[model samples]
Target chain A: MNAKDVPHQGSFRSSLYLFIILMIIWLVLTNSLKTEELLSGLIISLLLTHFLSANYRELGLPRLRLKRAANFIAYVFVLLSEIIKANFDVAYRVLHPKMPIRPGIIIIKTSLKQDIAKVILANSITLTPGTFTLDIKDDALLIHWINVKSEEEGEAAKRISERFEKYLKVVFE
Target chain B: MKKGVSIILLLILLWGVVAALSEMPFGKAKLEVAGHYTDYGKEDTGAANIVTSVVLGYRGFDTLGEVTVLFLACIGLAVVLSTLKKQGCGARQTPSLILNTGFRFLFPLILLFGTYVFMHGHLSPGGGFQGGAVIASGFVLMYLSVPKIKRLNHFVSTLFESVGGLIFLVIGLIGLKLGSQYFLNNFLPNGEFNTLLSAGIIPVIYIAIGFKVGSELSKIIDVLLEESE
Candidate 1:
């Protein structure tokens, strides 16, 4: 069953997560470590968590491990590098005299089974300058390419999503 | 035991609020504003609004930390929510022409209003947080009405958010070291009071916050809406 269909059974773990998150936010927004702020923040967060815990079932908290954390960090670096490279590539295209470019919509397939992984894959694709994810249907992503290098689905997928998908698979799954 | 803790906490909170409220001059004939303002001498920070003075001038260090916290909150939310990132799984909604047209026109206007708000922050009630929220709302409208602008570039969003925050921090550090020993006070000349150009560090600081908060909130909104697809 999908996450949304899950019953409103708020677990201790989810409640704790929500409470901690709220307390942290309260501290930050108040910008105070005073007893007053702490007491108020504690009470407010507890109250909010009590009320909102039912919906926590839909939040779908992930299980974390060291290796996965490291992989996720690595994925961030790779994404940053790609984004920077894409920026320059885009600048070059815009500044070029001829403005030579071919744009087209192409369908690309993904190996990611998890829904979260696929969404990140699509967003990462969008963040990289040359592509935009138009839609995601099943394991397929409809991407609008600024410069369509290949019409073939596999080639497009390799060029656009392969890099991010590699780390996302390990980190999320 | 739980009830006891809850009662104690509520009492403490009530005491705090009551203490603050007791100081207010609700129905005084000769208000402190009438007498003290004349002594306060030309809007100490040259800001017309006392709230602006407090927000971006007097307690700017707090504001800086607040903006940083807001940014971090966005990042945290994104990370947690991204774990559950299921988008385009559900059916899509097609936006009507009126909604599309409204987004096209209203988005820009909202942005303009936000800019105006933060710019006039020193003189008026609105400031960085309000302006930034206004700008983020524009992006929310864009997502809802215009289907073509699929997702905000997270790279761009982070860049703007960080750079904006960095400027605020750098300015504060410089003020702390070089200028008067106040948190974010600087030696810059305070321009004429009740004018757009007034409030030396305030307008600049608020504009930075506007950018930081606007982009940060937009990123948060984007992450949540990513699932809506």
Candidate 2:
């Protein structure tokens, strides 16, 4: 059987390629004329073999969604703008005497199918100022908010998820 | 037993998938920081090795957290082992002839090489963590070959780790106290670029890290070996 057909151990050629690459890297980094560093590098490379030997038999990732890539770019642009705007808004609040902190956790249930997309959405939410990723449970993100204009949790979740997840579903899931 | 091993194998396979997926463009995009290396490298606070500079200088707070992780691991090991109350396999007969002779001859050379790596870390890419691990392995070899080699003393290991932690903090604080910003370089005079003494607190800090890592790892090996025996 072909090495690729094994479904557990990756192609031997790929592993050899990686080992060579790592050896070259070690050589360049250490610049040691002595055999000791070479020996050490070989040992280290062997240790790293455990990581390379796996050929992704589980968590089968979905095919790339190219049409969604355009949407992802657009979404990212929107997200960046929103973050800048939020920063100024937060700064204004901070300087204000009221210190108006409607500090509460907002739970957002996202429709993003892929684990990768869900992670990006969660990370993006946390990246925005005045928000923190408190927990992620069952495709739902629990985010801590510094301020809330509306106490309605569902509306808040809807608004936040809409900006990020639409493009995310296309790119990752 | 077969089922348990299969479960572990399954988890490993899943992790392998994630690791491979993460290396792809989408995965890389998530991991990549938005910064130019030249711009960041020039503005880096201390040391020549960009990785070290990032870990110890720019992200000193993160380095503190990393050290805390090691500290936690050490503490956890101590706690777990303390409860076990088992003696090490110190009474096991020492390896005869071949292994003992070989270890006795190679041990010092291995130690010398480890020290060389630690000391030259700034000049090259290897740093405290990598060099210390090498040194620890040398000690491990001896422990495996010679059962009677006194287990790394718990108190000594604790002292080394604690003092290393303290020294790391003190150096950072001193830099701050002297009107340098947190983890600022040239707090101690920056020697010439390629020389052993060039990176100021970097070499000193790495040595402390080496001591901490070496002792902690040795202790870990000693504990595990003891339990096995």
Model 1, position B33, has a per-residue lDDT of 58
Error of 1 at B32 (Å): 8.8
lDDT of each: 0.75, 0.66
Pairs with steric clashes in candidate 1? B88-B229
Candidate 1 chain A: worst-modelled 10 consecutive residues by lDDT: A1-10
Which candidate number has the best lDDT?
1
Residue B8, candidate 1: C-alpha displacement in angstroms: 12
Lowest summed lDDT over 10 consecutive residues: which window, candidate 2 chain A?
A: A52-61
**Cα lDDT of model 1 by residue, A1-173, tens digit:** 23344344547766776677666655665565757447756775676567556444344444667988899999999999999999999889889998867899999988876445666778789899989988777678889988899999888888889999899888867
- Candidate 2 lDDT tens digits, A1-173: 11123334324644564456566666675676556557767776655544532322221234435676677788889789979988997898899998877888777777755434555677688778888766566567777888865556668876666777767766655
Judge candidate 1 at residue B201 and give its lDDT.
80
